[model samples]
Structure formats: structure tokens, C-alpha cells
Target: MLLKTFGWSFAVTAIGLVAAVFYGGWTGFGVVAILSILEISLSFDNAVVNAGILKKMNAFWQKIFLTVGVLIAVFGMRLVFPVVIVAISAQLNPIDAVDLALTDKDQYQQYVTDAHPAIAAFGGMFLLMIFLDFIFEDRDIKWLAWLERPLAKLGKVDMLSVCIALIVLLISSMTFAAHAHQHGGTHVDKAETVLLAGIAGLITYLAVGGLSSYFEDKLEEEEEREHEAEEQAKRSGKQQSAVLLAGKAAFFMFLYLEVLDASFSFDGVIGAFAITNDIVLMALGLGIGAMYVRSLTVYLVRQGTLDDYVYLEHGAHYAIGALAVILLVTIQYEINEVITGLVGVVLIAASFWSSVRRNKRLAEAEGSTEGSGKAEVSSGV
Candidate 1:
């Protein structure tokens, strides 16, 4: 299994390199490889988080993720997203904008950089809201907890998030509008655009994520019902076709996995702009990152690593929270991309090492216990 996994990765990498070389020669291939490695290193936490979700998906969705999902990650997000952003912000035709990106690379970067603050602001605040919702919101719906209900009634975080985002948009628009006016540039009425962009981000998150969550819950309920039926059947000594139904059950797991993979790709694709304005480079780097992340997810699932590493999920969520903050800060502050990637890498590496040490200790304790048991048994004999 390990050999096959590595072999596949190697083959993909080779193909990417060959394509890069044919397109842009040695310089291009070298750049792609470096970017790919950097992206992969920075996204280890993404892989772990993705593994948690993929485990819940079915095999069919998993195949879709490996195939169609790759196209979305590589071309849709990396290539088309930036083009769309440029078109909207620059008031250029979409084809013209893409042509500008391909022809005037330096000018394109400047345009992207000029628009970075707003993008950062939108991404940052959006991420912050997601983190807050995930971490603080009650995961369970309890029936008989009226006394603690007041705490729950502290107002809907989602609505509050929207309000805060709107306020931020207003302030940003006024500030940028004044700045633009002072420079004799056309006043960019960014308030509506900013708010709309924020709404788009939120809607995307909810639409993709909400449906995924709903289906997952439905699948879980069905599974539980089936399990109960199976138990009752066993009690009555009745046989059932468990084998035939197993494949159908596995398909839901694939759907869950694809949804999660999409989520994990969000930050990486957005963050790639901090490295290069070239869509091709962004796609190359993030594609490699996505590939490795997919491989890592498989490894974690196969090894049952999450069961052994309790803090791994915590670390990934923490990284997501940090990334969200970083995205938000970028809206108002210029942050180095290297710093963002480094922070994620450090946190994930620390968590993984901690897991390794924990596993070693557990193994030692088990060994000692078994040795003591053998001594006691021998003495008794």
C-alpha cells in the first residue's frame, strides 16, 4: 500500500514537472516544484482536517474528489477565481482581464495587490465568523436546559457576524473612497461591492457546508436505524443481507469527504495570491498541495491516526482560526504570506510530534503491564 501510494505521487509529480518543462522550460518546472513543496508543507493541518471529513464520505464521492474535484481546485478556484475578482474590481471585461493577466504580469500583480486589502478584509472576517461559530456554538440540542438557555439566547452569532461585516464594509469604503478622491482617482463605491462579496463568501460556506451537514446527519440517522433493526433481527435469529447493503452505505461517506476537501482547498487557493499573480503558478503550487493533502488524508484514515492523536483535530481547528484571523488582518494590514504559512506549519508539526510521543508512551506502558502480567502468571504456575 505504501509503495503504491508513493508510486502514484511520484508519477503525478513527474507528469506535472514534464508539463511545466514543456510549457516554460527548466525555470518554470523548478518554480512549480518549489511552490508545490511549499504549499504542501504549509497544508499538513488541512490534510488532517480533511481526513476527519473524508472518513464520513462514501467511496463514490471520494472518486469524484480525486477526479472532478481536482479540476475545481486547480482550474476553477486557482485560475478562474482571481480572474473573476480582477474583472469585478477593475471594471474590465473578463476576457480582457485574463488577457491583461497573461500579457501584463507586473500590472496584473499591482492590480491584485491594490485590491488585496478588500479581499483580505472579506476573507479575514468571514473566517473569523466561521471559527467563532464552530468553536462557541452549542453542538448539541438539549431539551431540558431552560436555566442555561439564557446563555444560548445571547443572540445569533451568524446575524451578529453579518452586522459586523457590514459595519466594516462601510468604514472601509469611506476610508478608501476618501483616499481615492484625494489622489484624483475615480471614487470606487466599494460599500455595496464589499458587502455583496462578504455575503457571497458566507453563502458559499453555508450552501456547500449546510447541505453537506444535512445529508451527513440523515445518513447517520439511517445507519442508526438499520443498526437497531439488525440487532432486533439477531435477537430473533433472523439473517439479513449486510454484505449487499455495505456498498450503498459507503457512498455517503464519499459525499462527506468531497465537501470537506472543498472546504480545505478554500484557504490555500485564496492564500496562493500572496505568492504569485500568475494563475498558472498558483494552480501548479496549489494543485501539488491538494494532491499531497489527499494522500495524507488517505494515510491518516488507513493508519487510524486520529484515534491515537486526540489533539490533532484541535490543532487543525486552531490553525483554521489563525488563518481566519490572518485573512481578516490582511484586509486592513499587510501581512507576509510566508508568516501565514509558517505559523500553520509550526502548529501542525508540533501537534504531530506530540501525537508521536503520546503513542510511544502508550506503547511502553502496555509493554510494562504485559511484562508484569507474565511474571505474575509464571509465579502462580
Candidate 2:
């Protein structure tokens, strides 16, 4: 099962490593490997979250995610995104941007760094909305019942999530972005840029996420109707076709996933320069990590891992909330990538452990109940 799931990922890794060696020798190979590991470590929560959404999609959509989505993730975000940012920021043409990235990596890195505030603001707000919406929704399974219950209750208030997100954006803009400074440079008030970018992010999330949810709900309604029809047919000894997400619903969901991925990649793209400024190396390395993440998402869906580990989604969202806060904080202050990755891993691990304990306790209770019933039956006999 493991080989079947991860065979393509392994192939990509081998190919990327070989190419990296040819491009920059063993040093390049080492950097690519480290970057791959780094991307995987940082985005593990992302995979969990992706699985939760992807499970609802039909097999065809899932295939599209693997093939087309991989291209967007690899070349579009990991490679072209930085170059595009540099071109716009540095007032250079696309050709010049590519040349600059290949020839003058320091300048390329600088242009990318200069754009970080806007990037952070945009990605942070988008991810913040995701975390907010997740926590606000009342679910049958709550990982942290003490907090989630109260939050879910508050969710009853119309647009409470939006209100809270806006408040955070306002505070972050006023406090952090107001006096943010570049390295060895004086304070530069980026409050306006942060505010605009954050609003754009928030709007994008609302538009894309809202549309996706609307269509998905429609799909669910249609599926429920089909389910009723199927039941009726079953009673009559007739066959009914299966339901699937299609048309506008699948398209918007695909768009939502792509945007969500872009938000997740914002930090990683910026942080990749800390390891290496070679665009090709970053793309190859992060692309391999991305393939593994996609594979993990598929495995989780097929294996029903989320169904067994009910609290896993909760943990991923909490990690996302923490990452949103970290992104906002990083607008003003430098944060170690190690701390970023560690926070997510720790949260997920703790949640997984809690889930195990919950399962064990439930099993023990069931055993006791069964034993008591048997004793009572024997007594009666």
C-alpha cells in the first residue's frame, strides 16, 4: 500500500536529486534535499487539511488535483511566482526578471524580500479565515471541547467570523505593519499596504470559499435526493447511479484548493531563499515535497484516516491559526522557520495521542458492558 501510494513521489525525488547534482554538484543536491524536507515538515498540516476537503471530491477531480495541481504547485508557485513578484516589484520585464533570477540571485532575493509584507498580509488573512471558519462551525466531534463549544456557540452570531478577522487585521496593521523595519534599515510604515493586501486576502477567501461552499452544499442536496431515490429503487429491486460533484461545484472547489495551496506556499517561497536562491533548485525541491503532500492526501482519503482520527482536522486548523498569527507577527519581526514547523508538528502529535486515548477508553467501556451482559445472561440461565 505504501509503495503504491508513494511510488511517484519517490521517482520525482530521485529525478530531482540527479538533476540537482548535475546543476550544482553535491552541494546543490544537499540543498534540494534539505528544502524538500523543510517543505514537507512545514506543510504536513496542509496535507491533513487537504485530505478533509479532497475526500468529498470524486475520483476524477482527485486525478485532476494530482496531475494539473502538481504543475501549478511546482512551476507556477514555486518557480514563476517569485519571478513574477520580482518583475513587478523591481519594475523589470518578465525576461529581465528571469535573467535577474538566474544571474543576480541576491537582487532577485532582495526583490522577493521587499514584497514579503504584502505577501504575508495576503496569505495570513486567507489562512486566518480558514481557521476561523473551521473553529466557528459546530461539529459532532470536537478536539478541544472546552474552547470549541463556546466558539461554536458564538458562531451563531451572523458574520462573527468575519468581524473577528477584520478586527485582527486592523490591530495587526496598526501595531505590527505600522512600524515594521527592513534589515539594517529604519522603520517603514507599511500599514496601508498591509491593510489593502489583507482586505484583498479576506475578500478573496470570502468569494472563493463562499462560492465553493455554496456549490458544495447544492451538490450535497442533489446527492441527498439521489440517495433517497436510491433507497426507493433498492426497495423496488432496481439500480440507481452514483452521485458525484461536477459542473460549477467541482470547478470552484478546484479553484479553492489552488488558492488555499498558494496561501500555504507564501511563507515557504519566501523562506526558501534562506537555504538557496537558485529558482530551479527551490522548485525541484519544493515540487518533490508537494508531490509527497498530494500523495499523503490521497492516502488519507483512501484509508479513511480522518474518520478514524476524528480530531485530526481540529489539530490541523489549530495549527493553521497558529501559522496565521506567526505570519502576522513576522510582518514586524523575524521568526525562525524551525519554530514555525515545530508548532504544527507538536499540535498534530498531541491531537493524535488524544485520539488514541479516546479510542482505547471507548473500547474498554464497550468490553466492560459486554462482560456485564454475559454475566447477567449466565445468571439468568
Please give the lDDT score for candidate 1: 0.61
Q: Candidate 2 on 286-350: residue-level lDDT in tens?
A: 88888888888888888877566667667767866787888788778877655665676677778
Overall lDDT per candidate, in order of appearance: 0.61, 0.76
- In model 1, the Cα lDDT at residue 124 comes to 51
Query: Which stretches of candidate 2 lie above 4 Å from their native place?
Result: 13-65, 81-95, 221-285
lDDT of 1 by residue, 1-381 (tens): 776555666677778888778866876776666557555654565566666756665666556666776677667765677677667666678898788777887777666666655565456555555554544445343222353255346435546655655565566545542332211233444455555565666666667678678767866865786688689879999987665455555556555655665665665655554444566666666766667766776787677675666445445545566776665445434566557666656766676677778789899999999999999999999
Error of 1 at 77 (Å): 3.7
True-vs-predicted CA distance for residue 229, candidate 2, Å: 8.1
Instruction: In model 2, state the lDDT of residue 161.
Output: 84
